[model samples]
Target: MPRLIYDYTKSELERVSLSPDRFRRKLKKAVSNLLPYEMELLQKWLVFYTDNRPELRQCISELQSDHKGVC
Candidate 1:
């Protein structure tokens, strides 16, 4: 069983590991479909997964500051 959020699996997320830009796009897509409660888990998972990948972390940091919510 894989970690899922709105039909997206953890592996789907993992596949974009090398490209932080793509990861940001995919994560934004995932976040769009999540309910309010699920957002927290998504954030936590984002933190855990992006740890040690500063570029990805920077992408995440950028995502957080996106008020317009555009990917």
Candidate 2:
């Protein structure tokens, strides 16, 4: 089964009122139920959005700075 393991920490989810354990369980179930074609469609949309948008590339740099605590 495919999984959607989030990279965020437990403290991060707590800050957002999302229980990490519960979210992970739900994500596991959802991912297991997703069809292969659904995953392909998601990949297509991701490519389409990122490939066609220059602003998103800039956002990626901003996100990197935020990750490094320099934002």
Candidate 3:
């Protein structure tokens, strides 16, 4: 069965909250796993999630232009 977005989002958030490296890794994994609509929702959530995290914001900004994959 496919994973539920809520569970995936929650688990990944907890897993990557500590560092930018982990956050980037998990974001890539999420991008690969989720459908386009799911990814869009995830991106929105990511903006709120990363809003206060300068390291994560920097990491995201450094992603390739094609994969600017998050908000």
Candidate 4:
């Protein structure tokens, strides 16, 4: 199953020793500071999904590998 948004966000913050609420507040402020066009681009990318599910899975796996190396 896909992870819930709250669970994913909470785990990510915990991995970096960040307070989830504080991080969210900061993110909200940062997003609010974006220009309208920038925000529109962000929304587009945020909602983009692959038509090929297998390719999406592979992309996510590759990202997870990269994340493991960095973190």
Candidate 5:
């Protein structure tokens, strides 16, 4: 699953989202400043991220299965 809405690359995602905390911080910053298209992209990213990475969703969700968003 991609932690970012836009996949610059696998390496980029890995570099940016190195830790859960870091990922959340980045995600919050991003959400605070989103382009219109990016908002749409984020919706897609959420679907993919959650679908492909349940543990990631769980971790960010603090083990709440129904919770959403990274930050």
Candidate 6:
């Protein structure tokens, strides 16, 4: 089964060592501070958090493009 939003976000928070509030701040910072490649990964992670397969697939496709000389 696919992961739920709660589980995904919880794991991400632990991985980054950030409190919920700080994670939110960092996510916002990423919007401006991250490079195109980094942003694509972030976007894919965010979409995965939603547990929406179609959207996640779309994000993955875009992320793949970033690896193919698009970024």
TM-score, per-candidate, Cα-based: 0.76, 0.31, 0.75, 0.30, 0.49, 0.37
TM-score, ranked from best to worst: 1, 3, 5, 6, 2, 4
Over 42-65, each residue of candidate 1 has an lDDT whose tens digit, in order, gives: 677778987888888987778778
Residue 11 lDDT in candidate 4: 45
Global Cα lDDT for candidate 1: 0.70
Highest lDDT scorer: 1
Point out the worst 10-residue segment of candidate 2 by lDDT. Answer: 5-14
Indicate whether candidate 1 or candidate 4 has the larger TM-score.
1
* Tens-digit lDDT track of model 3 for 1-71: 34497467657766778988887777667767777777777667667877998888776566535486443
Q: What is the C-alpha lDDT profile of model 6 across 1-71, one tens digit per residue?
A: 22343345446544653344455544444444555655566566665553544533444355446455321
**1 versus 3: better TM-score goes to:** 1
Q: Rate the local accuracy (lDDT) of all candidates.
A: 0.70, 0.39, 0.70, 0.39, 0.51, 0.48
Q: Could you give me the TM-score of model 1 versus the true structure?
A: 0.76
**Deviation in angstroms for 70 in model 3?**
7.4
**lDDT-better candidate, 2 vs 3:** 3
Model 2 earns a TM-score of: 0.31
Q: What value does the lDDT take at residue 70 in candidate 2?
A: 20
For 19-44, candidate 5 gives per-residue lDDT tens digits of 76655555555555555566467656
Model 1 alpha-carbon miss at residue 40, Å: 0.5
Clashes of each: 0, 0, 0, 0, 0, 0
Better of 5 and 6 by lDDT: 5
List where candidate 1 sits over 4 angstroms from the true fold.
Answer: 1-3, 6-9, 68-71
Model 6: residues >4 Å from true position, as ranges?
1-20, 50-71
